[model samples]
Target: MAWDTEATKQKLLNAAIDEFAERGFAGARIQEIAKKSGCNRERIYFYFDNKIGLFEAALVQQLVTALDDVPVRGTGPEAVADFAGRYFDFSTTRTALARLTVWEGLERGYPVGAEQRALRSTGKVAEIQNALPSATMREAEDLLLTIVTLCNAWVSTPNIHLVLTGAPDLQRRRASIVRTSELLAQDTV
Candidate 1:
């Protein structure tokens, strides 16, 4: 596979993702990541400066992969609903991302490399704003954040999806997102 040539680097990234997900930034360790990745400690520094750099890189990679999976193209209420559904599904599938991101922001502060992260996220927000021409940028950002926060909360809370009523968990989650989007649009109107 393409990742084989960069096996060590990819291992380090994957290890960092798990470590950061489990332990957050302050608690995550280079030794543990190296051990998990089956590589020497020097390899991390050689590839990514330090633990901070590695964590940031892994987080960035997660966002990039998410964007690839859910590209910003369609617009309107249905488009917004589609984005919300896609995002919720992505977050649920990639459970580690919410844990890592939440833990890092809560325990370790988000100043490090936030600009890059925001830049990548901004495209989606802008597209949403464009879709809803009547909605201001701030309003679009707020609505988008609310949908993300709700999905993150649902995923973070244990067995919340089970409490949810539907034939399948995805159906339940999608219903919740669509309902929330409808509320947001109504409030805007």
Candidate 2:
């Protein structure tokens, strides 16, 4: 029987994501990941080179999937609202990915793959810019940043949100974010 290297690699990646999201990079254990994936510890090194490599790959993959799942389309407030709602849905539902992001910032100080990450961000910025035709590139980027931050904060800091709002309601928070994004988009036009 032939081993499916890709399938094995995916299982490892999935395990690593859970481990890293829970413990952060510094705290995550390779042996635990191995045990969780039912793979040998040695294979992690073979595929990812090191713990850092696995962390970066896991994070990058999550971001790629999120972006693909919630792409920006069309022009103006309605489109921006659409993107914001979808992005919020992705971010909130996939809390692990957002947790991984927070973990990376705290442990790494600066993000890994600064240039590559910037390129991916550039794509999102462009999408926002295209939707808000009257806005400059910088404005679009800032707006995108604002929408992301607003959406992520509620989920990432549920306790704080509950304290401030008296409830942690996904539907309400999502509606607020979408309304804000729509207004921002309308202001540009």
Candidate 3:
């Protein structure tokens, strides 16, 4: 039988994402990932070299997917609001990405995927800058960061989110982001 390396790698990634999201790097087990993936343990080393490598691959892949899946639409304050709304929806609905990010922060002693991540960040900021022509790169980055952080906060720390917001309604939080984005956009517009 011919080996399907890509399929095997994808299986490993799918398993590792759940494991890393649930357990973090320090707590994630290679056996669990292998068992969940139904792939040989050797495949991990062959495909990724080590557990850290798998985590990095899974994290990067998921981040890319999330970014690709959610896009900001339109221009000006309306566009900013749309972008924030889309992000809020993405973070709330497809929650593994946010949890994985939190896990990465806790487990990774040094930065992971810095070069690739910087590129992605640059593109997203540029998209925002384009949508709001009057906004500078710094302003766009700050706005993007703020929107992402605000959107993810609920899923990252539900208890605190509930305590502050008085409820766990994501719609309410999303509305807040849209309003905030519109206000920020107004500054540029």
Candidate 4:
């Protein structure tokens, strides 16, 4: 049977998500993604140029989904709260994507074209920056770093099985993250 266009694209995207999650951009294999997606290797090349393209596509898709789910366009303390909650939700639900993002950060710092989105995201930082009437540039940087560290810690701590088990630890960890984020945000203000 032939796959429909949407189904085929979704399969490719899902396979890419899994493959890139398991391996970073450099290590992911097109063959593995093809096999997982129930398609041929050439099909992957047809859909996406190569492993790098697939990984980048996966990242962009994930980022788009993330933005849709928890748009942080608001620039306020509530925005920070929403950011903490939504980030935890997205990361926990999509552990593979979370891990892949972490790996990417560790390996390459940030994607080259991230400035487009990053500039928009900087509004949140600017909100916090504005709230800190006496804050210096270093203080703003520190505030951003603290939030990132706290969010990553909470988001990445839970595994898939832990999710399945309805583990109390996930809640506990998330609550800790939210509290820490709120506290840190308060300090910034």
Q: Write the per-residue lDDT of candidate 1 for residues 91-185, one digit (tens) a residue.
A: 88887777776876787675456787788668767877776777787887887788778767765665655566433466666788877885685
Candidates in order, TM-scores: namely 0.83, 0.94, 0.95, 0.69
Report how far residue 170 has shifted in candidate 1, in Å: 5.4
Runs of candidate 1 exceeding 4 Å displacement = 1-7, 159-170, 186-189
Q: Candidate 1 or 2, higher TM-score? A: 2
Clashing pairs in 2: none
Best by TM-score: 3
- Global CA lDDT of candidate 1, please? 0.77
Q: Write the per-residue lDDT of candidate 2 for residues 99-152, one digit (tens) a residue.
A: 888888899997875666678888998988888878899888888888878877
- Sequence-dependent TM-score of model 3: 0.95
User: Candidate 4 on 44-102: residue-level lDDT in tens?
Assistant: 67777766667767776776665556554455455555567667777777776566677
lDDT score at residue 169, model 2, on the 0-100 scale: 78
Q: Could you tell me the C-alpha RMSD of candidate 2 in Å?
A: 1.3
Question: Number of clashes in every candidate structure?
Answer: 0, 0, 0, 0
The pairs that clash in candidate 3 are none
After superposition, candidate 3 runs with Cα above 4 Å error:
none
Give one digit per residue, the lDDT tens place, for model 3 in 1-189.
999889999999999999998899999999999999999989999999998889889888877887777776778889988988988888888778888888888779665777787788788888888899989988999998888888877778889976776867767778888999889888877
Instruction: After the best TM-score superposition of candidate 4, give how far the Cα of residue 121 lies from its true spot, in angstroms.
Output: 3.3
Could you report the Cα RMSD, in angstroms, for every candidate shown?
Answer: 3.5, 1.3, 1.2, 5.2
When 3 and 4 are scored with lDDT, the better candidate is: 3
The worst-scoring run of ten residues by lDDT in candidate 1 lies at: 160-169
